[model samples]
Target chain A: MSTALAPARTGSDERLTGFAGEPLDQRRYRRMRFIRRFEETLLQLFEEGALNGTTHACIGQEADAVAVIEHLAEGDHIFSNHRCHGHYLAHSGDALGLLAEIMGKEAGVCRGMGGSQHICAPGFKSNGVQGGIVPNAAGIALANQLSGNDAVSVVFIGDGTLGEGVVYETLNMAALWKLPLLVVCEDNRWAQSTPIAANLAGDMAARFAAFGVPVREVDSTDVEELSAIAGEEVGLVRAGAGPRVLLIHTYRLCHHSKSDDERPEREIADRWLVEPLLVHGQRLDEADRRRIDDEVETALGEVVATARALP
Target chain B: MIFAKELGDTLRGALTDDPRVVLLGEDIADPYGGAFKVTRGLSTAFPQRVRTTPISEGAIAGVSAGLALAGYRPIAEVMFGDFLTLMFDQVVNHIAKYQAMYAGQATCPVVVRAATGGHRGYGPTHSQSLEKHFLGVPHLRVVAASLFHDPREVFSDFLGRDEPVLYVEHKLLYPQHLTLPVNGRIGDLLATSEGGPLPTVRLSAVPVEDCTVSVLAYGYQAMLAAKVIERLAMEEEIFAELLVPAQIAPMDWAPVERSVAVTGRLVTVEEGADGWSWGTEAASVISRRLFGRLRRPVDVVASEATVIPSSKTKEASILVGSAQIEAAIRAAAR
Candidate 1:
């Protein structure tokens, strides 16, 4: 399993380090790179038919998962949509268990019952569903409030999931009850093949703001920016300031899945071709970039080598 | 005879006995105490446990599912069972699918309580037996607690198990009652009752020990089935074993299968529409499993597959009574 590599360190470097001066340490950076490589490898295996079933790869949305998950404590809850490989990995889920789940193995996270779309790790109490777990997360947030626990419930959804009526209903109730919830919307500009501008009418942030929720928007590609904003938002929710929505503008470098090929639309593909890992890597100097690249490649190489050795 | 008041008291006592049990519903708090007064004084007794929620059926079901996931046994009420349709997403998709879809990642030990069935002209919106809607959803245990004694036992059994349960209480039977065996506590039946003149005829009794026929009945049909048994005993010297399953979804097949093995005949009676009813499904199961049991085919006595009429004449024509049950039993015997 391997991912196609983009040209390293070629894009605009000035705008990248503007937010929070790259707060990620070597360990965190290595972890995020691990997620990026893991997702890319999964996509390759899916295309090769080595892995069965469809997977929603978090190619460019790694920062959002990492940042939001970093703010969560061990007992904190997370609910994710179909595009949740990053969220599952960043929350310390078992890589083999997740892979097996996607492959429909009995040793999967849900014992092969729930496929790639329905991965749930009971240890972390993290669930992956197709926008249906939004209200369930709100209920979990309410439970946290009822129990007087400072733990927060975070739900990661796409801009398309906002179109679901239950999400809005859950938002309304979450706000009314002052539940500790963080609804992170990864606005990656496309809901499958359709563009978000063509589908959504008004501002996504304004909609949540209208519900009296403290809403924020950040550069979803920048790990530091997402971390800072997510930290602030998590604090606000933990302090009983009700539910909040963070609209993170990210990019989906790959197709929605291996089955979906969007290369026919060159203009659209070109516009959305912001490689998140390369962009983040470019912000650092030559030494930092080399160190990060080596670390990422070594970890990915180990994973691939290990995966191949499994019977 | 223990009435609805005693039943309510019994439930309150049970809740008091178990701290893990929590109740949430509309108007279940102090002063209001449930529409049918089943949860009367429960909120005051267990203030933190008994909670009142806004009229959000989806949230009610979802919250109960969450609490169950968190290891708290939550019994959520939908006030009227008709309103449960509003929460079909959470109940069917989330709560029911947790065990199977999650491969038992977490047990949804939640009980959804609601009052259902047509009685006292509550109109089309309020009066409906919608248990058939949730008949096939996996991992959800549906319990229709009609009699006072069976309800306590069913509730106890449901709470004892680590599965999501849909406890459907009849709106009309709320005022009715039955004398429980031990201080209003219905003990579990060790084996089904057998031993009547016909060997297939069994008595329809709550706090049932052992029975032969596994007579399936619920709501008003349950009372009618008891009367039919009594009349049969006096006139024809025929007795039929009755198995009133409090739980419906995972239809407690143990007793039902055992009863079928003994009697080799099964009769299902319901006061709901006949098309694709629970009775029909029960008949199918019995026929498939006990096909070579050397008796007659399973019989289903249910209401006509039509809209319940408002007029007395039309309603009587559409409804299933004791006579229909008796006829169904006779057909099964043949």
Candidate 2:
């Protein structure tokens, strides 16, 4: 796993990269791009006073969702945090339900009850409580292991969630019980308004390693590499190698929620240069990228239209 | 059968009856058999399903929620009811809200069993009736074990249900015999039961007529109230009805209503510290429903609002015992 914070090489040089001997699918790019546009559209709706409550968009962290979800099997479950739109879309592909849910429509996934932070679809669940879902994910893995099913449980948490103590308690149990759990810690370097340095003490990787759970760290914004690492980690967990962690050191491109970005403007601009979409989008042909973007725009437009028209 | 043995047998029956039933707790496995021995010999009978978890109440609850979501009926033990505060977020924020928040996309058929109540001298933290804190939490059922209510029926019913339940087992009642109502009578009190899943039993004197006051309680306090009512009828010639609702949360007001309607006065008894308690809610609800019919304001007999001490005499004074219930009933009837 690469530890360098510099942007990975993109464009034609990375066009043919694959994980597990399978060529990189264009659908990955399409999914990542769709999540990006969907959340960006949510922000637009938030500004227009069309949405209720708050939303934590995974604008720059789309690669993590798209990549990690690719390795999940049908029975495998994904437990996500507040910033769960990307994970929900990548896992269940129910954008309309999610969109309608955020709009508080009756046809929403959770019948509009979950809203933005809480979403529940089959094999996919998300909650806004930081680090609270870690044990839940471990529990699913425990069930699968007990039932003799090879299903893996994957949970996505932000760097800020590490401040919660339950996460460590879960890690202790997951490692001790040999539960097939893959913990994807998306270290976006910021916990709401506070930076990682201010919120977290000691090392993130060492935290998991202390419980004897293996850690696979990635620092690049490239979806291909992230998918590769996620695949290996998920495969190992499924193969009964106990619980593992994939600490993706990335940056949140958007505000924490709605216009709460207190970071330096120069820092935001610097992160934008190496955003996941740009890195992965550069690898796709111009026409292919344009086609995917157009499809995402149309799909998102239809979702918004349908959600707004809901009674 | 003893209360703990009946609970253990009920759990064993549940484990034998369903493969989906899994037990999670600290020291609940054979040998250790939980702090109260309610789960004794379960892990030995069903080793695969009976899992002894680390002392992590939050994880025990979260894991149980996860299992329930995956189509398993999990019974998680929180060792002591006071430690339920540790699992508060998981129960209130996650387990309780999953079904409603998910809009029926999920159902958590998890039963968290915590041994509750004082009189054991475990001091401030261990000996507490914290079920009051969890009452009225949406989608969460709070059921207490009583000598009148069979543990087998309760666990079996929980296995068939989808909602989460906080099963409160009073510590003092563990060794006591389960003297169930025979021919609608337990000892000198005639038991008229109402409701289902969790029944509310109305116990009165045998020739049951013209009860002066209705004493409402649950769990061990209900037993204490039974003793008080029987003694009141036998010694003082003061007849009072004891209304014990096995299920506290989403309380079945039917029995209370019936008893209060006849007696025209009500007194709620509980072991929890005073203020914002189950008794308070019962009093308020019953008072509202039977406003004109009641003869006087409903009385709430609960523990003194203070930390429970380890000293037996101090704990006795701080806790609600038979004396308090008898005194309150005498006053309410007067």
Candidate 3:
């Protein structure tokens, strides 16, 4: 498992200390790197035929998973769909267990029952199908409401997932019930091969607004800005304001999967120019950047060795 | 005939007693009391937990799965049995598979209550019995209660369990008063009638020694089967033992196997269509597990494979009757 944003038991750094109740930007930075490294490792394992099934790598969508999830408390549940490696790594931080699951090992989080597509643990659950997790996530929110707990439920869906009818059905119910839910839709331009523009009709804002849910969308590639907006929105839901939707306009640099290379070369080339890591790193001082880079490198090296040594 | 209101009272009792039990379905709320009135006064009694969802069958059942995972035992009622098809994917894929698939990481303690069977003139969509569609799903408990059995106990029992259960009810069985022996498999009713709890009620047609065949049944068919047993005792003096399995999936086969073991003949009855019904499963169990003890081939009484027509005559022709049970028993005995 990658200890990216580990529990407070770890010793604090002297130069850039993240003490109790402090904003952990450095920690989230490492978490994103961990997800990036984990997905890269998954690709290599897939190439070597070490993994059983094909994985929908969230390589470029790391910022969307981290920025939103970073605001949630430990007890808050996250329901995930196909492209969920980043979400699992962000929430559970169990990269090795995820790798073990990809390899079909009994020691995996779901006991080798659920692989990359179907990963679930304590406080986190996922399924393979798009639009499948949203309804259940609403139920989890209802559970929180019934139990009188302030905990919120978040579901990670994509722009293309709106093509599924159940998402609208679930949205209507969630809004009607006044359940505490945060619906995060990562719009990465393309939906596998087909673009979201071709299938989805109607104004996105009006669709959710009519359901009585507050909708917010960020077109920026900056992770910190995304995090700040999400934190405020999460606070609103936590304060009994009902469900909210965070529509993130991000881009995926990697192919949808290992087999996917049908995307236009020019389109892929343009997207790489404004990818997250380089742009996001320029904000921090050179010393802080190097520190995070060194920590992430050491963690990735150890993560690879631990994943390979398991079986 | 035992009326179905007693069953309603039983469900009401569970809600009143336990805080975790919540009744959800179409028109289950005040003034409506459910389409069949099975959940009458439940919303009035427990308003917070009980709710009338917006006819979204898939989401209603899907939400129940979430509610169960979150700790409350959600009783999701699909007004008619046919609508359960809309949510069958959630029932079969998520609710049933969650506990087993996630290795206990998730549990769906949901009891899906539906009115199933074809005696009413409601047509193919509204009146068909589709329990067979979900008969063999793993980790899902299939229970169909008749008037003779304790509907209260059935709801309370499955409500307390950790896994998901599909509890099927027949519309006609509701207005009828239930009648069955307290204890024993087939003929041991007199012995078990003395004392103790009856989880697996096997009302005897006659004493074990006098019994000619063991009739295995559940749901509404239990009444038809009981009628046949009564007539067989009076007209032919050919006694047959009846086995009403309260729990269908992972069936309580001990008393059933014992009944067939003594009687040397076995017959299974169900309201679902003939192909791949619970009766087929019972017949298979008898042939494979108790073949040596059987004196003849096992018989199954089930509705024929066809759409349930709206006309009264057409409906009667398709559904199994006491006459069918009687014939099956006579053939098994011979």
Top-scoring candidate (DockQ): 2
Whole-model lDDT, model 1: 0.69
Q: Write the per-residue lDDT of candidate 3 for residues A1-311, one digit (tens) a residue.
A: 12123343233231222335544666556566667777887898799887887888887788888787777776788999889888887776676677788788887888788888788787888887667578888888988888888888999998888777667778888888899999998888778877767867887666778888999988866778888888877888877899999988888777787778677789878777666666576766778768777766676667567766776
DockQ for every model, please: 0.40, 0.67, 0.66
Q: In model 2 chain A, where is the ten-residue run with the lowest total lDDT?
A: A8-17
RMSD of each: 6.8, 4.6, 3.6
Q: Give the TM-score (vs. native) of candidate 1.
A: 0.85
Estimate, for each residue in B25-66, the C-alpha lDDT of model 3 and write its tens digit.
888898888888877787887887888888788788878888
Name the regions of candidate 1 deviating beyond 4 angstroms: A1-28, A122-129, A201-203, A261-275, B1-7, B10-20, B148-150, B181-214, B235-238, B257-264, B292-295, B310-313, B330-334
What TM-score, computed on C-alpha atoms, does each candidate reach? Answer: 0.85, 0.95, 0.92
RMSD after Cα superposition, model 1:
6.8
* Cα lDDT for residue A178, candidate 1: 79
lDDT-based ranking: 2, 3, 1
All candidates' chain B TM-scores are 0.83, 0.98, 0.93
Put down candidate 1 lDDT per residue, A1-311, tens digits, no spaces: 01111111222121111113344544346556767777877888877787776777877777787777767775578877778778877775356667777767677778777766676774244444444577677767767776777877888888877776667666666777677888899988888888887779898888788878888988657776777888888878877888888889887766887668564577546644555555566666778766666756765566555555554
Candidate number with the higher DockQ (1 or 3): 3
Error of 3 at B264 (Å): 3.0
How high is the TM-score of chain A in each model? 0.84, 0.92, 0.90
**Residue B22 lDDT, candidate 2, scale 0-100:** 92
Quote model 2's TM-score.
0.95
Higher-lDDT candidate among 1 and 3?
3
